[model samples]
Target: MRATFMFRAGDVRVQNTPDPVLRYPTDAIVRVVRACICGSDLHPYHSLPETPGGTTMGHEFIGVVEEVGADVATVKKGDFVIAPFAVSDGTCEYCREGLHTSCEHGGFWNDTELGTGGGQAEAVRVPLADGTLVKVPGAVDESLYSGLLSLSDVYGTGWHAAVRAGVTAGDSVAVIGDGAVGLLAVLSAKQLGAEQIVLMGRHRVRTDLGREFGATEVVAERGEEGIARVRELTGGRGVRRVLEAVGHLPAYEQAVGIVRPGGVISRVGVPQYRDAEIGWPFFGKNTTLTGGPAPVRAYIEQLMPAVLDGTVQPGRVFDREIGLDDVPDGYRAMDERTALKVMVKP
Candidate 1:
């Protein structure tokens, strides 16, 4: 099989790799059908600390089940399924609490002892099949692939940002950043019943898409001016809820600045700063801050109906598609912001 790998910073290669096979009774082998390059993959692609060996890239994927070990029960051969970025037991207390990302028995594919990188390959070995794989029902087609693929990561991530912030009908919400996740956050905020969804991003392509996704307004400014814009929009009250989709310190600071006192902020962006203050600025405001890696498995059931019914189109974020061998270009396009998000099909 062939898979994407990173030998060093700024270099992504597709190379022949050993095919995956069931290593545990609870595992399954999946033939990759569709996969995507996530924004987080750029973390390592940029400058992750030196590793003795190159690293495998990619986590978001949907595929057809090829073989399952004896213990695997939730899905079987021929089933079309999606796997969250993390592998989970699904029966753990954390999983039960809808926080499967922290599943006691699970870890990220690249970080776990198994060291298997995900869906970027022609095939993959998935452990904890019952807990990790969400089988799609009925007919499958290329039209639905990107939307279904989104349930594995970006869509669920945005949903987390909105839900964690307690976005409700009649509430005014602002999403910080306008990357794929940020745009999805705008969609999620709308679905969760926000009366006003404001997107803060400067990119014309992304902000325009954000408007399509239900952002009632787009704020292209940043820092103090950005805060004032939100305040002026809300009659000097700021927004009632804020979804922080950019992990950079400036983005977080913007989230803090634009959110009204006593409002909540949910952050889904992978934070890049070493020090971020929450208490001091939040002092006396009773601000509630929540969010982390979205437990995508936990969200699949809640989010799929929308995808299946076409009520929402999270996959619209995917602006470019490439064959598996061309995944390196996909990475380059996303890194340069030439593409909102890239889809790679195997």
Candidate 2:
């Protein structure tokens, strides 16, 4: 099998790797059908000093099961499933309480430990298969590829951010990034009944998709200018809910600063902080802050129906498509802000 690997910061390559095999009774091996490059992957791709060299890259994928362990009853050979980025045992205390991401047996598919290679490979080993894999309802189609692939990360994550922010009917919400996750946050907010959505992005293509996904306003400014514009749009009160999708310090600060005094700031960005700071102004504002690695498993079932029925098309965020060999180019394009999201066909 050929898998994508990040040998060092700013380096991504597709090279031959050994095929994945079932390592646990709850595991299943799947042939990768569709996979994607995520924005979070950029953190290490750009500046993580300790990012291990020669590690398989990628974490989002949709695929068909080629084999399953004896204990994996929910999925079997030939079933098309959505592999959530996190593998969790459904029976864990945390999983039972809806915190699947924190399950005692939960883990991520990475280069270390029980590595199943990367989603950007020809096949992947999915642990806790019964709990982490969701079968696509009915038939799969070309139009459904992106949506199915989204179930692995972005769509579920964006929905989690919206839910954590407490977006409600008639409330105004602001999304802090224009990537696939941010655009889907706009869609999720809309589905949650928000009356107004303000997308903070400068790209016309992304902003345009934001509107189509239910964003009522698009603010192209950044830093103080962006915050001022958001305040101006909200009658100086700022929005009630702020969704932080970019993990950088500036974006984090912007999310905290743009919300009203009693607003909620729900962040889904994988913070790349060595020594993160939250000043006095944040505490003085009395705003509620919440967010972390999204427990995507908890929301997959809730969001799947919408995707299957055409009520929401989170897949619209995919702006470009490339083959597995072009993944390095995809990363470069996204890093340069030349693409919103890249869907890779293996």
Candidate 3:
């Protein structure tokens, strides 16, 4: 089967690769129904050395199981399922504690030796199938694809950020970033009962979606001006919770700066730097910081119902759609900010 691979930085192409098959007793071979590009993939696309040839890119997808190994009982052939970005064994200690992303037996699909294949491909090998795959209820439909696919990563991740930020009814929440994850953070805050949801972004399309997702205010400013605007909106005390959806230094600082003393800052963006400076401003604010890669498997079950019931339409984040052959263009469009999120159908 043909798969998308990163030959080097700035070089992503669709190339012929070995077809994926069941590799473990708990594995499942999935014919990908839908896949999409992710922001994290852009890191390697722009970084050197890390841009090794043959690296498959992508982590979000929903698919139909073509085959399942002997021990996989929860799912079977022909079932539509959402494959979380991180593959994990359900019985692991970490998974039992609701931290599937850190499961002892968990592995990131793109980084494993098997290279199970990315969502941007025609098919993918899903390991620990019974543990990592969530069966979509009832029949699948066009409208369900985007939302179901999001359960694999962004939606759950955004919800995790909101939860970590301690969002609650009547609390003012500021979401820093307008990407799919950030926009979802706005939705998550509203779902959690936040009275005021402020989205900080520059794009009109993304800001529009943020409002639909529940953002009551939109601040297109950045740096000191952005901080001033957030403060101004919160009556100068700052919001009670801030969601940092962009992992860069500026976004991090903005998140911290816009929250009131004793507030919380939940960061969900993939950090680009090894060491981000945290000075007196961060410490003196008495704010609590929490976040890391989301444990999507842990939240999928809890979030699936909302998607099914149409209470949350996370798929709205996908503004562009393409086929497997057009994945390179999908990456370019997202890299250039022409699309909020791109959905690739195989």
TM-score (all chains, Cα) for each model: 0.98, 0.96, 0.97
Instruction: Summarize candidate 1's per-residue lDDT along 1-346 as a digit string, tens digits.
Output: 9998888888888999899988899999999898999998888788876655568878889999999999998899999999888899999999999899999988887765865666799999998899999999987878999999999899999999998899999899999989889999999989888999989999999999999999999999999999899889998888989999888899988888888889988989999888777777776677888899999899898899889999999999999999999999999998999989999988
lDDT of each residue in 1-346, candidate 2, tens digit only? 8889887888888998878888989889999999999998898798745445577888899989999998989988998899888888888899998788888977888826555677888999888898888888677887888987888899988988999999999999999999889999999999999998999998899889999999999999999999999999999988899999988888888887789888899999887665544566777778888988888888888888888888888888888999999999999999998988999998
TM-score of 1: 0.98
Where model 2 places Cα greater than 4 Å from the true spot, the runs are: 48-53, 274-279
- The C-alpha stretches of model 1 lying farther than 4 A from their native spots are none
Measured by TM-score, how close is model 3 to the native structure?
0.97
In order, candidate lDDTs are 0.90, 0.88, 0.89
lDDT of prediction 3: 0.89
Ten contiguous residues with the weakest lDDT in model 2: 272-281
Candidate 1 residue pairs in backbone clash: none
Q: What is the Cα-based lDDT of residue 121 in candidate 2?
A: 85
- Which scores higher on TM-score, 1 or 2? 1
Provide the lDDT at 236 for model 1: 88
